[model samples]
Target: MKLETLSVRIGRDVEPMAGDVAPAIHMSTTFERDSDGEFSRGYSYARADNPGRKALEQCIAALEGGHDATAYSSGSAASLAVFSLLRPGDHVVAPIESYHGTAKQLRDIIGPMGVQYTFVDMTRADAVRAALTPATKLVWIETPSNPMLNVSDIEAITALSHERGAIVCCDNTFATPVWQRPLRFGVDLVMHSSTKYFGGHSDVMGGAIVTREGGTLSERLRDYQGTAGNTPAAFDCWLLRRSLTTLVCRVRAQTENAARIAEFLSTHQGIERVFYPGLASHRGHDIARKQMQGGFGAMLSFCVRGGREEAFAVAGKMKYFTRATSLGGVESLVEHRASIEGPHTVTPQNLLRLSVGLEHADDLIADLDQALASRS
Candidate 1:
């Protein structure tokens, strides 16, 4: 089935339990077990497993074209699930420009745990190939990467890692299942902060990790999620299930709105550069065009004519696009990337990342037009 079809069927189908159309939430924290002290389906507690998460996992795994998936409290939890597959001495390669929180987690949390990582220019296949070492166990990447929309060559990176017996994992939050399926390309694992595209409305917070091979890595991560206790709530799963049903529809709408806004920024006087995969001027246009199916993506970044102060002015002026963090919500958001990433980070001082929402494209465009006009 297509992603559109899969999205609708994936958590919404309840197998006619009492002939109810939508699945009901499982609110019980503990389950009744058989006399032998085993669950009917091996589920004994909410932290270990639940019917709602299983439903969501199966649905998302199907959409990502993977064998299985796991859910978490936030995208970070799902991300940690993938990283848990590594050990104290393992090394990993990641793109230089990434979400600030993830970068901090890698440096602050994992580094102290003795897991070493290198940040390279993933756009250049040569740079990725050179970064590979015998101790390298994984390659973490984001295409149309956060804050800066820099697209990575997945095929090259995956091929490079596979040659050395390393697993490749991608954070597909920016490009949801509607636009791209990483498993189709030799990738071993795919992760998402379901709070973004999967939750659509951004009301719920959750994360998911999907893998083509649900072998040792999947088993270990599942065990870690159960033991580590970062599992998502049943209510969040229920809301996320509801969000997935309309995932494709909202993404299509946001994509259209984003394209118009990006084009407007490209020509506007207050804008210096626009980072959108749809734009022909973008460096990764060819790769993204080849890898992705329909629209480019809803997330974009643009630099104002001046630096940080001017960028904040533009963000403050947005009426429809809220000046805040996080994306893939029903509403739009604008944030100055450099300020949030800190002065030591790679983000430019002049840029603002925009998460295009489901608002009318003309209204969004007009607001941006006026916002830039106010920058003068």
Candidate 2:
């Protein structure tokens, strides 16, 4: 079935108790056992499994074409689950510029735990290949990386990791399954901060990891999830499941808006550079063209003519684009990413990241135009 069909139909098979089309949310913390003291339904406890979470996991697995998926309370929890698979003295390779939270986890949290990691420019596959060693257990790829919007070649990196006996995990938050399916590129695992695109409305917070083959790594993550107990609430799972129904439509609309905004920024005198894979001028245009399916993506970033002060001024001048953190929502958001990422950030002081939303392209452009003009 097509992604559109799968998004809406995959989890709708539940037998609604009241003849309602919407799937019911099982809010009970625990399920009853049979009179013989044996488990009857597939579920025994909410922490171990819940109907809503199971439906969401099934939906995400079907969408990404993965063998199975594990849902988490937050995207960070999902990252931690994957990192927990690595033992002391194990090595990992990741992009130099990625979601700050994930990078921090690898560098600060996991690094001190005895696991080693190397951060390299993943856009250059040679850099990644050079960073790998016999000790390397995983290669983390985040195409169209956060803030910078640097697109990495997933297939190239995956092949290199496979040659070295390292599992490859792709962070697919920026490029949702509607745009790019990393599992199709032979990535061993695909991860997402479902709080962003999957949640769509910015109300739900969740994370997920889908395994292509469901091997030992998948088993480990499942075990860690159950034991650690960092699982999404039943209502959050239900909300995420509901959001999937319109994932394709929402992302496509945002993609179109982003393209228009990027084009506008490219020609504007106040802008120094635009980071959008959809733009022909982007360094990753050709590779993105090959990997991404329907659209480039809604996320983009640009450097204003001056430095931090000028960038903050521009962000402050926006009328429609809310000055906030987080992305992949119906409403547009603009952020001075450097400030948001704090003192440890590598994002340029002059750069502002934009999360193009479902707003009309012209209105968003006008808001940007006014902001840029005010800066001049």
Give the top-scoring candidate (lDDT).
Answer: 2
lDDT of each: 0.89, 0.93
In the predicted model 1, the residue pairs found to clash are none
- Stretches off by above 4 angstroms in model 1 are 15-17, 374-376
Best by TM-score: 2
| Cα lDDT tens digits for candidate 2, 183-261 | 9999999999999999999898999999998678778888888999999999999999999999999999999999999
Clashes of each: 0, 0
Q: In lDDT terms, how accurate is model 2?
A: 0.93
lDDT of 1: 0.89
On the 0 to 100 scale, the lDDT of residue 237 in model 1 is 88
Q: What residue pairs clash in candidate 2, if any at all?
A: none
